[model samples]
Target: MLDIRPIGRSMLNKVPEVTLVFWLIKIMSTTVGETGADYLAVHVGLGTSVTGLLMITLLAAVLAIQLRMDRYVPWVYWLTVVLVSIVGTQITDALTDKLEISLYVSTAAFAIALAATFAIWFSVERTLSIHSIVTQRRELFYWAAILFTFALGTAAGDLATEALGLGFNVGVVAFTALIAAIAAAYALGANAVLTFWLAYILTRPLGASFGDLLSQAREYGGLGFGTIYTSLAFLTVIVALVAWLSFEADAGGKPEASPGA
Candidate 1:
């Protein structure tokens, strides 16, 4: 029925090497993920556990299909990302809502999970380079880390807004500033891998806070746009970007690293 092959020494056809556009799209996607998850849970009348379970099931199936494919396809890659985004948002929501876990505790827990994931990933692959994600093991680690980032982002964002007494708009501004600072650091001799991962982690909270700012009601200190509107706007932008990239450039931009290098 389905081919379940392990990735090996062959070259990787990942969606794109990390670039400015890549980060832009990533933040947009994560924001959509946050809003979309909230929409499903609240607007659709599905509780957090139900929504999380449903999204996780769907993500699992999509990931299975993605893993089955021998090479990366843009649509497939983006779809997988979208699903993972929802599931990741659900994870944090479940912990915070259902379990009554504090934001700081969830943040610490997710941080530990992410760190453990990286340790195992590096120990197994002997390299944490995103360009080298040609192996099934590497891909698994990558996805796992991504899921953790979203959860960690949710917790971290909540901590900033709630625990730290910064409102949503202020949180967004703070995270935006942090991201800009990280970019500057990356430009000034910081390790590419380190900077890339650091930025990757930061973008999650940045996007999540922005999503809340756009989607939540004004009484909640947001713009009162609603989740559906926010999701639609972000999805539309994402689709446009994908379509443009498909026709204008290759699936992704120029290669970051050569195969087998």
Candidate 2:
């Protein structure tokens, strides 16, 4: 059974700690996001509209559970992320594929929206730091920013790989390099919060490109692993990691408290 119970903790931050495992799972989740969305929409024959509606409904339910929680719960947090990824991908695909909007236009629009969200969030909270998510309002702002990031990432990724003709292999490498540069900057004393968000955004495209490399046919410069296998492989790893995190939390691990702005 899904445990929706809130755990005892001193702080109210509802996000996981920034760690290597966190990034590992995040990248894989994006991979699953790309492939999973494709599988359900195309291969499963639900079509994009039906897939989008189904995923949105599921995301609403999971997000409600997440909002009700008083503190971070690994499973809940990750589940919300996965659903958001799917919904985000669907949002981008709808605009680009159905509405026939230019990728450049969608990318810029999402970017402006994300910047506006951050501006409003910081104007109200005085902090754009994830470490300060101790209130419901801040958490809401965080999720809003996250949703935009995923959508922006999807549009940007598709623009680069498909529209720009970079292809999957080069897309993965370019995004990976960009993230590495960001990490190096952070290590050299850049703002932690900014670096974190930058990396988080890039990882989505990097993972998506990697997913395509594995799932697409060899003629398309991919390995032909197929969407089902690619999604399943990444999802298995995600589930195992979440299980471990939950076990540790249940064993009385006091997660890091929310830091002040």
Candidate 3:
């Protein structure tokens, strides 16, 4: 069996430290993912097929750079994540819109994919902790899991808000409550790794719900800000936060480096 213990102290892992800023940026990136994909597909007249291909290409390039890096580079890592989010959203959108698949079916499919990814990852690596993402194999698993989470989030969010008639605002509230409960459970001594992954998965839907709430038409239970404006605003915030993290890292106040597994 693969060893579960932390590895050498000097080796740097590719992922960032889990902190308040990390969560903040993660939510913002997810929101951008939702709105950005909509903007490109609808407003920009690219259609889901074209937009998906473009975003997937970009995500592939960015991920290649990220994988080649020796350590956690804030800008590269977050850019890859943002692109992944967009591509993941487009994936679900294509399945539901173009293929005419039901949101319920897509959600169940993505959930199964995520669960299988986790099971295989743990079976091979002996750990699912982000802190143990040292080997290239583990990093591949991590990215695969992240992609499925975003896709699952898109399907689940749409299923709740659109298919179930709960509306965007209600979906946001429901997901927010779930995340808060997860946080409470973690505080009460829930398994750290489990709680972390649960919260991570839930945040994608929460952020996507909020994205629709802000960007959809007023008649559609939203604020009517529209996708373009909402995407730009959230993208600005994401850029600012990533820049701050980069500045901090350059100032010799880098986040704690994860040891190799």
Best by lDDT: 2
Model 3 global lDDT (CA atoms, 0 to 1):
0.88
Candidate 2 is scored at a TM of 0.94
Query: Judged by TM-score, which candidate is best?
Result: 2
The residue-by-residue lDDT of candidate 3 on 117-153, one tens digit each, is 9999999888998887677778889999999999998
**True lDDT of residue 244, candidate 3:** 88
Using TM-score as the measure, name the better of candidate 1 and candidate 2: 2
Task: Candidate 1: give the clashing pairs.
Answer: none
RMSD of each: 2.4, 3.4, 4.6
Candidate ranking (lDDT, best to worst):
2, 3, 1
Cα-based lDDT for every prediction: 0.82, 0.90, 0.88
Clashes of 2: 0
Report the lDDT tens digits of candidate 2 across residue range 91-176: 99999989999999999999999999999999998888887777778888999999999999999999999999999999999999
TM-score of predicted structure 3: 0.93
Model 3 spans > 4 angstroms off: 1-11, 257-261
Looking at model 1, report the run of 10 residues with the lowest lDDT sum: 252-261
In Å, residue 144's CA in model 1 sits off its true spot by 0.9
> Would you estimate the TM-scores of all the predictions?
0.93, 0.94, 0.93
Enumerate residue pairs that collide in model 2. Answer: none
Encode model 1's per-residue lDDT on 1-261: one tens digit a residue: 766675564546554656666777899999998999988888999989889889888898899887876556566677788888788888888888899998889999999999999999889889777777777777888889888887888788888888898988999999989888977987787777777787888888889889999999999999999999999999998888777666544744534443211
Task: State how far residue 14 of model 3 sits from its true place (Å).
Answer: 1.1
